[model samples]
Target: MEGQFTGADVFFVLLGAILVFAMHSGFAFLEVGTVRHKNQVNALVKILVDFAISTVVYFFFGFAIAYGTSFFVSASELSGAGSSGIFEAKGLTLVKFFFLTTFAAAIPAIISGGIAERMKFAPQCFATVALVGVLYPFFEGLMWGGNFGLQGWFESALGAPFHDFAGSIVVHGVGGWIALAAVMLLGARIGRYTKDGRPIGIPPSSVPWLALGSWLLCVGWFGFNVMTAQSLESISGLVAMNSLMAMVGGILSSLVIGRNDPGFIHNGALAGLVAVCAGSDIMHPIGSLFVGGVAGAIFIYAFNLAQNKLKIDDVLGVWPLHGLCGLWGGIAAGIFGSTALGGMGGVTFASQLVGSLMGVAYAFAGGYLVYGVLKATTGIRLSSDDERMGADLAIHKISANPDTDIMR
Candidate 1:
């Protein structure tokens, strides 16, 4: 118990924990804001349930699989230094669990928006179980464990080990890829597309929810990035500040690029946050600003194309904000990472390129396989009744409907 909660340590941790907790509300409101007015309650409930499920998974198998003794740490998982995680210290295991469970919880939060207003809570629950319980463990072990882990093949050939400072790839990337798979299988929402192939724009029910959610997310993101250092180390303070810059950079840059574009005010900030997650520890604040700026601009363009042209029906923009920005974060970590900030070992340009590819491969392959199975077996798509009724009231029978006379 003492090890679990010391006064001084708790000071920092509680602050971070509280902020992270607030992110749940942020997810709820943001998702609600992006979905159509008819589905508002559905969006909020999905966020709630995802967190609830994540909490349980975290305490049970997730913590153990991510941090505890791997039931099977392959010989390849051993260190090139001849040590395997076989003898990993108990404390390190706990530390890993702390980082991983938090990370694991975030994956489905992003996915919720993609499959919003449809999927049965049960199917979604099953997918989350597979993701956190089995799928995420494999990726987590592979990326962090390296030679003394399951992904020895990657370590043997990949340049410099897989380095995701704050899970730009692990958390955001995994979420993005899985969300994509879900969105692909689920198809577009009703009336979202035309037989003529024209796209329809369905605004979210609550703009206030979107703004508030973005604000809360911005607040929690500090913990998400700073906690990557796991302590107030020599560089923790700077990393925290760097994260701040990226968040702001994403907002300001988008405003400037869009020149007061109303459609994307909230999205720009999120893009910046995602872009900076990977290299927050190593990159200078100035570099992060530029990187985040690029991410914000790219997100605006990407989102416009998806809704306007591709007609993919990404209700809450799962692709651009999470997937696209996540891709940027991995690459930026490489480009902006300086040797001084606990980043790339050297100041060379080539290292950044390598980091980008590694992040993409790690997330895409694992994410695809996990969601793919569900798509094949359980058939991940939702029935039209669920889509029309809104998932909240339809699946769980929660009465968020505006039409309800008593609530009115």
Candidate 2:
């Protein structure tokens, strides 16, 4: 019976890994649909390659940094034939690595959208290595892995530990803030701004593709959130319910607030999902709805602020959707996850604030440092000629579709 349960746990997490892995396709399609036709190939290639690099770096370095576990031991130890160590659960640890790795890879995937069209391929790959191998894992260790006793301190000082049912702050917030730094450092795409400080809009190439990406992500997010349980016994229907409620709230709110803008409508659902990731386990369904609605509204406002007033060309508005909304999700966990709100208690607003802010600070600093250094030495942006030609031709030497004349 014990052996059967262990096998079940392994299968559960393995499925989660597969589902999250599928989300990368969603990421690729999202970017493909968002960027212009000239750069569509680059969008597809970047997500896949970045994910590849992330897997290698995270396996060798980031996983160790976050969990203090390594796969350098013998096969016997790894398979749990030897006495239990970090490689416990009869090879389940390795599968767990696969699951967490998808989350780690998402940081680069999120950043890819913000810096798209203008970033040089090699530099972005370097940035990916640095991020997955070091920067992301540092904070990941502090929060999820309990490396430096940050959670312990939060519990002692704030009446409850910071509770992130999934990874609202850890994944989305970190990705969003990091992407913001990259976007700011890379500067706007050519013609995205005028000499007189006015902003110009870059319309998406295909709204249908964008919507497809959203649907794929929305579907896979169930695994992203629910499978944080890591075991069948630990899984909660509440988490699933909250995720659904949050997604709808985001959809409906964005429909109203964004005035039927397809872009905003699609992304608003993502905002709700990002916001609910932190508190899904604790918040009631109604609370989740409110959280999603607020997140949807936040995305509309903040995206406008970042792009228009701030003049920051965060191409996909990732900072608003993931960074700010994820931060809200973290804090919302404290408010909506309270006993008074019909949630399972054991959260404090102060702790949530502290933890969420810490994530933001770390993400911003790390992103700036990594991207800034790369910008100085390796040259992160493409040349003016390359910018004019688009990333498909400049980096990949191909367009999404060949001209009919060329084919003939």
Ten residues in a row with the worst lDDT in model 1? 73-82
What's each prediction's TM-score? Answer: 0.84, 0.98
RMSD of each: 5.6, 1.1
User: Which candidate has the top score in TM-score?
Assistant: 2
Counting clashing residue pairs in each candidate, in order, gives 5, 0
Query: What value does the lDDT take at residue 308 in candidate 1?
Result: 80
Clash pairs, model 2 backbone = none
Candidate 1 segments whose C-alpha is farther than 4 A from its true place = 1-7, 70-99, 147-159, 339-355, 401-404
Q: Which residues of candidate 2, in runs, are more than 4 Å off?
A: 403-408
